[model samples]
Target: MARVHAPRLIPDPCSSAAPRRPLGNDDAAAALGPHPGWARLPLVVLATMATVIASQSVISGAFSAARQAERLGYLPHMTVRHTGQHEEGQIYIPSVNWALFIGVLVLLVVFRSSERLAIAYGLGVTGTFLLTTTLFLVYAHIKLRWPLWRLIALGTVLYVVEGLFFAANTVKLFHGGWLPLAIAGIMGASMLTWRKGRRIVMAYQSDVEGPLTDFIRRARNGHLNEVPGTAVYLHPNTVPTPLALSENARFNRVIHEKVFIVRTVPANVPHVAPQDTVTVDRTGADSDHITQLTLHYGFLDDPDVPAGPRIARDHGVDIDPDTARYFVSELTLLDAGRYRGMRKPFTLLFMAMSHNAAVPADYYRLPRERTVMIGAQLEL
Candidate 1:
């Protein structure tokens, strides 16, 4: 309200001058010259504190969003630490924190001053604003059931304003504005590549491995060497049996007495209750030895492959969690330049990422001694 009425509320000395001079720093200091030290010092401190608070909020928001993205399969998983037991949202990601710290330090060193940094800052802020507006427009139309005319009208108004702001920022493209665009472009490309690469890999695996029901039936009829104790296989698709299981039976010529197929699906919710997280479905009534376990995890929930047996036990499926052996499919991509659609550079990048991704044993919380990785080479 003070700012809205400032022109009328504050006395304007320029009103008395025939040709008014622009207000300078000296004029502002002169205006504040009457304030005592106590008042001035506190005001300056308050402004600094407010700036710090705002920056902290933005930093925290970025961390939270990154973690959520990891859960939704948009990014790789990083270590997450809960800062407070009572506060579920109070979490810290060490990697993101350090990256942000280093990025800010580099920015400060390069820009040297806030005036120079403002050119880059506006691009980041306005770019994010436009993206959020675009996403929300779709969300409102589809999820919120907004009318078509209302959507078009609101979208046009917002796009015009934000478009102009973005265009204005483009004027500073060579003057540090390119930094945010470059960063955004790289990150966006990497994420899209990862998503596409994963889908392609899954599709390839599905083609290689047939349906789970058929595999189970064949194994039962073949009278494969039955090994003692339960064995759990983590599969990408619930319908298709993992190559790991087929490979184990083919090469090793042995199968566990009780085979559990565990497939995890990430839910849209934040956190699913532990009790309702696992749902067990038997592969067939005739085949009591094999069961299909579907694990539903929230975007924030950790997927524990080792927990499948325990969850099965709780639900009256006969199995011991401690003695179960976990089999995980480890793909070795052979880049023969056979893949299409995804560029070769991105395919190579995705391959590098897959090689560096967290090992299934550690990620799934499986016992190091008991967990076995079945490797298969696939040409791409």
Candidate 2:
């Protein structure tokens, strides 16, 4: 069967009518029948459907990767909409979707023919295979505790094969392979810059906010004027006092009667157990009325701010969800001329990314009406 189909599926180089370009799957499909002309339309339709399915998978994978990167602090927070009610992984990221759409348009305009596009696709696939194999080997050694000799042997064999393919693809770098490499480089640099910038900003904010325990001590010492109503401040961690809480106290000269410092922690697992969702600590005595709520969410879990306090209620924390006010800090980046933390270019990129990132209220599904944004400036 293979011998009989070879002539039709693959163009013969010796044949005078052989096409200049290599035969693709579409061509092979069309050539399968006795009459190629009659099978062309059906092959086109099938190819179109296959392309749609492939594109859908790529888009979905991009969304999932973007979300995971954001959660892992490699990328800035973006608006994530959960598309599936039961499946947490089924998410739609508008930013990623639009970016991919624009990229596709640009690539289509730049590379008009599939022949040229194939060069970039070859490099992309081989590069992906090489990196994935490398990562898997590392994971096997560290996480799976594979023997060093076995790992080295397997890795050497895999790397040699993939390296040869990658090297072959690199020969076409100037032709079309440079496109994917350029895109990967840009994305990698952006993610690294964002991660480093965030660390610098976080360190600065930590210094400004001070220790949570010290702030609690101050409140216990009657330093803060008590006001009526419940206030929930969303923080990244329980170590430092939330910037919103500090700013509110500094500007208004008062703190809420019942203050809830909520921190949503991302768990390692896909979905945290329902019973282990929330952990509430009253901070000090019952008279203090200052509670530290830690909401544990898996990477796939939705970090809903408004629902956090309600979840705490089930965990024996007295929180009034109806009348609660949410407080979040809005950070404005200022480039310090003599700043040594990050490079000037990266600082600018980080600032722009930060400006475009989704606000906490919208990202966490907090009620806009009840949410208060306390502006804080950070010099980088």
In TM-score terms, which candidate is top? 2
lDDT of 1 by residue, 61-139 (tens): 8788877777767666566767887876788887778878888898889889888889999988999889999999999
| lDDT per residue as tens, model 2, 1-380 | 45554444776788988767788888996788556578789999999999999999999899989999999999999998888888867888989999998999999999999999999999999999998998998899889999999998998999999999999999999999999889999899999999998888888889899998888788888888998999999888788999999888878879899999988888889988878888888787888888888889899888877777887787777888889999997779887774547778888898989988987888999988999999688777
Query: Which predicted model would earn the best lDDT?
Result: 2
List the candidate 1 regions with Cα displacement exceeding 4 Å. 1-55, 334-341
Q: Kindly report which residue pairs in candidate 1 clash with one another.
A: none
Which segments of model 2 are wrong by more than 4 Å?
A: 1-35, 335-340
| Candidate 2 lDDT for residue 216 | 77
TM-score of 2: 0.88
lDDT value, candidate 1, whole model? 0.82
Candidate 2 residue pairs that clash: none
